[model samples]
Target: MKKPTPYTVSARLYDLISFEWPVYGAGRSTAISLLDLAPGSHVLDMGCGTGLNFPLLQRQIGPRGSITGVDASAQMLAQARQRADSAGWSNVTLIEADATAVNPAALTPHQRFDAAIATYALSLMPTWQTALLTMISATRPGGQIAVVDMRTPTGAAAVWTPLARLACRLGRSDIEAHPWSDMPQRLARVRSASVRGGHIQIRVGSVGRDGDSVPERDAALDPPRQR
Candidate 1:
């Protein structure tokens, strides 16, 4: 029998209990702002969960842009579908597949995305590096790729480490994963930000035409306000 993923069992109650508004939302918002997407762009939201990033993405991509959301949990995808439907967004597509193993070509045949983002999602997969590489593969050259994930709080915020670990444990994520650490080495012109006392890390970078480094200046965005 297949093991039940954390999201499969908690999809319905996720939004309410996942501490979205209070904690994690800032990371997604900060990452999207760095994406600098234009209208009519096609984006990939890997491990989309319940599509909490949908509204923010829609605001940037507008009605013309399309969103391809991939998640392993059918229940989570169902919620994401409902979110799109309720908002009357026809451009959102939800696919059930593992981010670590999904074929990029299957995601969008004959075309690549304008941008691909995985917000607070990668750490859940033990093979997060593979998933991040897949995200890079799925994006077009000169396109944007962003990742937002969590870690233990830092400095005075270290007091919250236990609570942060608890949250990560519940979500089946590794608080020590530090998935975004690999971004600078993989992508070009990498931009970064942190929020919630560094518990959340955001990285955005551009893909070179050769699928290597793009020769552009790297700058880090000012950290978003901690809540």
Candidate 2:
């Protein structure tokens, strides 16, 4: 297989990592771990590139629930649409729009979602804070927000930090791309963060209306793949 380019990396990695996290268990845990949503729940997926979480959500919510995937990248939206079509999923809708700029008028007035989710796209965002506030605004007051990203624990450049830097250096990417440092807390302030999980290095968190003492679970990023 040809190596994935930078522009194509987002779409290419969708399916590969989508089911790998296993949040608490396997794919089942990962899917449920995204949010504590009930059946027939309506969800808004922010920056929902290629709709990685769409399949699990679709299955969980059944035919009655609806999900709208909003992404700024047209290529990603196209890929997501293709994936949904291939899966014969009619409940998923892909829209070419920035998460931060979503207007209530864009969807039906009666289409307020029960929860919103963004997977791995948090760090990729430019203004992650504004993007999150937009996420908060898009949902109902008591709605839930599930966020996942490549998180780095705060510490001086330790062993793994240097290794991560070396990898980025060799790859000509930003070695100091510590994207999750303050973004999670910023998001948590907007909504109480609950059940934070992921490899300890790359954390994913779930934020909702009524959370006070959600525990952080350890998870590793770039886990060695199963042969």
Candidate 3:
């Protein structure tokens, strides 16, 4: 058997050690709020990690909607499955696969998702660019995608740099990876918000018909088309 890493060592204790309430939770909440998903809408929670975002996402998606959460860690998925089972959320689906390599078509066999979000997960993937492109490809045209991840603090908040670096090191995340910066080029109506003294960045954008953005007339008239 493989030795456990930070994520796999204690999946059950992740929520407590993750600093959700004071630090990372704010980014997840803010990012999900910006998704603007409607009830019954299908959403994807990339790197769902112990289902930490499930309850918040469920509030927006409701019982009728579904969530497909993908992660590479089996132990983490086990914990996530437990959370879903305890909550009696039949709508939640957990997949054990690498987000960087998993084929979206296999995950969403019938239809693409209405919205997708990745919270504090991308910075850990070396191929985060491919992971993000897969997310965009998995959503329907005009659907929303949100990326929430961290970076070193700015301005006066730079005082927190050492602490931030230490946290990232402990979590096995790249503190310098600005994965959210690529959103504008791939999607339209891109918008962003920063919090925690600029350490966390939230970016939400609508998938464009052409990936460069459809003309207003085309956007109004055309039906969903695969990218």
Candidate 4:
């Protein structure tokens, strides 16, 4: 039998206990702003726990746009479904699968997305690099890919390191994962932001054209087509 994860066990209490407004929310908001999504754009949300990014994404994409959210935990996906239904967001699609291993074609059958994002979720996966590569492949050429994750607080915020570490540990995330580190190498025109005393890190970048090579391991994962 598969082991139950914290996400599965805490799906119901996630929003109230996740420290969204006080600490982590800034990171997601900043990444979405950097994406500069146009109205009607299609977006893929990897590791989209409980659809927390839905409200912000919907505001940018409007009613005509669509969101495909993927998560490994069925319990979490259930919560995400409820959130979408309550908001009456008919354009949201939720899928249950491991972000690192799921095929992009399975997420969007007709076309690649205009943008892809993962917020505070990648560090939990041991194969976060594969997840990052998947995000790049799921987007169209020149489309945006954003990753928002956690790390130890820096500078004056270093004083809060213990608390930050505690938060990440409780969530079963690795503060040292630094999943966004590869964004600069894989994507073009990379942009970044740090918030919550440096505990939150955000990176947004654009997918390269056809001649541009994605990492070798990702080559078999349905690389994005050139425009």
Q: Which candidate achieves the best lDDT against the true structure? A: 1
Candidate 3 wrongly placed segments (more than 4 Å): 1-6, 211-227
Per-residue CA lDDT of model 3 for 114-221, tens digit only, reads: 998999889999999988988998999989999999999999889999998998888898988999878877888777777788888888888997644542321221
Q: How well does model 1 score by local distance difference test?
A: 0.90
Every model's Cα RMSD, please?
A: 1.3, 7.3, 6.6, 7.0
Winner on lDDT (1 vs 4)? 1
If ranked by TM-score, best first, what sequence of candidates would result? Answer: 1, 4, 3, 2
lDDT of each candidate versus the true structure: 0.90, 0.57, 0.85, 0.86
- Candidate that would win on TM-score: 1
Clashing pairs in 1: none
Rank all candidate structures by their lDDT, best first, as comma-separated numbers: 1, 4, 3, 2
- Tens digit per residue, CA lDDT, model 1, 55-143: 99999999999999999999999999999999999999999999999988899887999999998899999999999988899999999
| Candidate 2 Cα outliers beyond 4 Å, as residue runs | 1-31, 104-108, 153-227
Angstrom error of the Cα, residue 189, model 1: value is 0.6
Off by over 4 Å in 4: 211-227
Question: What TM-score goes with each of the models?
Answer: 0.96, 0.64, 0.91, 0.92
